[model samples]
Target: MDGLTGLLDGARARGAFLLRSVLDPPFALRIEDRAPLTVVALVRGAAWVVPDDGEPARLDLGDVAVLRGPDAYTVADDPATPPQVVIHPGQRCTTLRGEPLTSTPGLGVRTWGTGPDGSTVMLTGTYQLPGELSRRLLTALPALLVVTGDDWRSPLVPLLAEEMSRDAPGQEAVLDRLLDLLLIAALRTWFARPGTAPAWYAAAGDPVVGPALRLLQEDPARPWTVAALAAEVGVSRAALARRFTELVGEPPMTFLTGWRLTLAADLLREPDATVGAVARRVGYGSPFALSAAFRRVHGVSPSEHRIGAATGD
Candidate 1:
């Protein structure tokens, strides 16, 4: 798979938070949900996304805006609009004073709003858990990335709006998959714009480094070396190293080590995963070897990392 696809493969949105927000002209919502990622699409009318640290961006119909979070942001009819509702972690809606507003009557299936016939309408999907998105992919995004409707064409906005109101069996799973697709589409479109692709993404199109990267991602558990990777990709070790470093901004082996450790860190978060098993799964020869490397690179032992993740320390 290509690098973008490989990174996106990790996005398994389990019961992802989704909603169709309908609001009147004078409305604002302060979102402090701290979700890892969120996609906001304007279905009707227009809206403004005011990120905590970036300039406010206006979204017209069919425009999609991606917001990276853990930091709070505001969505409103205008950048100056005061927030009337606050969405907390777990998507709990409340008034400004922490009074629960979740029971405030819903507009429709998976739909909520200030009024029934509000002027602005938006569809939102949030990946609540950090694990739902790979760190590799998240790191490549800005705090706020917008794909204007004029830049690309996609039918996902309408499709998602239709599916949001469904209540059939396995519907949650379907929405999750749909959200994933929408995210991928938006990102692919964003990255395809001139001068917007990340280094690794650009490197994926290089003849010499592309195949080598695929091999590494497809079989990260294999015992791989620069020379071996070069041979497998039909190039000399020195040549491959130069091309890979130039294009991807890292040596092949260095990149492979980071990829393995990233996989190990994610695997280590599972309750049933033991250090030895994770080590073996990520190409280390033994638990001790993996532990040393992990500590050196991440400044934590496998056990310590697991404990911290568990306790949210």
Candidate 2:
């Protein structure tokens, strides 16, 4: 159910990118220093994208990359041999095409970006994450992933393409959300690959562990004991622990604890949910115990989590 649950949640957190003419080029653009979780999809022509820690990569249509850190990187057509004339972040962008992309009066939502040849080479856009799970996903994604030219018939892509032709109300917000879902699909498909990946990603490949993970994800507070869970899948507790540790990098209980805490944190963020309610939801009988454990893990109490979460922390 973790995979299915992830799919559903991902469908909700989707976002998008639209290109307006004001910033159209004959000019260049850079990230301008301040770092945010950026998902850049090259929906048009190919360009050279340079990350701080990595070399310049060729980003073409359907190519997606997440700029993990805030380090500024140059995304331009040419390999900045001498680099372009630079300016400060949030300061004057000295690039010739400094006009506002969205301010272009004739630009429409169903419109597209124009390439150097005046052809719609790409439909590029960028977005940031909404939830912690999504943020973690952004961090975990490879620096560059090009999903183009039949890289699986992505439902997200068609959704994006179809949206571009519609004349609906609140279309921009709708497009952005759809873009976020595309990211989740891309991430999911990436993790479904085998060999050489993080433990959690690799865990998706283990027959028993995969099912077990789904079970845990389905209901974190279901009084799941190691012995019972192991037996449910016809393995001894020790065998289950060994397999889980090998693939998931933590014993089942430890993984469950972390997952429960994540759910508990989400619950704590709810305005109507109290400490005791969150505690019970996460499998604890006492708020005191949950608070103590939560503080030990998060360096704050349930109350702090509620307050911080309420304020969009």
Candidate 3:
């Protein structure tokens, strides 16, 4: 897999919270949901995304904005509008005073707003939990990033909006895949913009290092060494090492180890996963060996990680 695809593989949305929001003017939401990520698409009227630590971004019709969260932000018709509602964890809605907000009426399936004929329309998809590989992508983003219609144009928003209100079997799975596609497309466009691509992303286009990265990520269980990787990539060992380090900011083996451990860590989160199984899957010879390396990098053993993941601690 390519760098972008490999990074996004772990971030696929499954039963994510999605909704079509219709509203009139003077609408604002103080979002402290602590979700890892959220995608907002302005379908009709305009809106503003105000981040706590970054400059406010204006979203015109057909624009999409991605908010990397765990930090607070506000979405409103205007930047000056005060938030009338606060979105809490678990997708709870309440007034600024913490009283449950019952005034917002349901417009239709998977939609809520003041009324169906509200002037502004927006579609929102929130990833409530962090993905296994999302850490790499999230670290490369700012608090908020906006992609305008003029920069990148696609029918994803309209398509997703139509799918939002549908009631049928397996609809949630469909929406999940759609949301993943929209997010992938948006990030792909965003990363293509000047000065926005991360180091690993940018390095993926290099002829020498790109294939090497794919090899490491595609088969983490393979026992790989510098000479083996270099021979496979048709480069001398020293040349491959120098170029990989210069471009990827790490040696081949170091990158391999990190990739292996990342997979192991994610696998251990599964309730049925055992350390021995995870170790074998990620290329370690024994659970003890994997534990030592996992602790050094993650600061926790596999079992400890599973517990913490389950408890959200």
Among all candidates shown, the one with the greatest lDDT: 1
Model 3 RMSD in Å is: 2.4
TM-score per prediction, in order, is 0.89, 0.73, 0.89
User: How do the residues 132-231 of candidate 3 rate in per-residue lDDT, one tens digit apiece?
Assistant: 2355566678778899999888999999999998999999999988888888889889988877886667788899998898888888888999999999
Lowest summed lDDT across 10 adjacent residues in model 3 is found at 130-139
Q: Candidate 1 lDDT, tens digit per residue, 1-313? A: 6677777676778789999998878989999998889999999999999988889999999999999988999999999989989999889998899998864385878988877788889999999877677767777788999999998888888999999988899999999999999999998999888677777778888889999988998899899989899999999999999999999999998998988888887888787999999998989999999999999998999899787655434
Q: What order do candidates take by TM-score, descending? A: 1, 3, 2
Write out the backbone clash pairs for model 1: none
Local distance difference test scores for all models: 0.88, 0.60, 0.85
Model 3 misplacement above 4 A: 131-136, 269-272, 307-313
Candidate 3 is scored at a TM of 0.89
RMSD of 2: 4.6
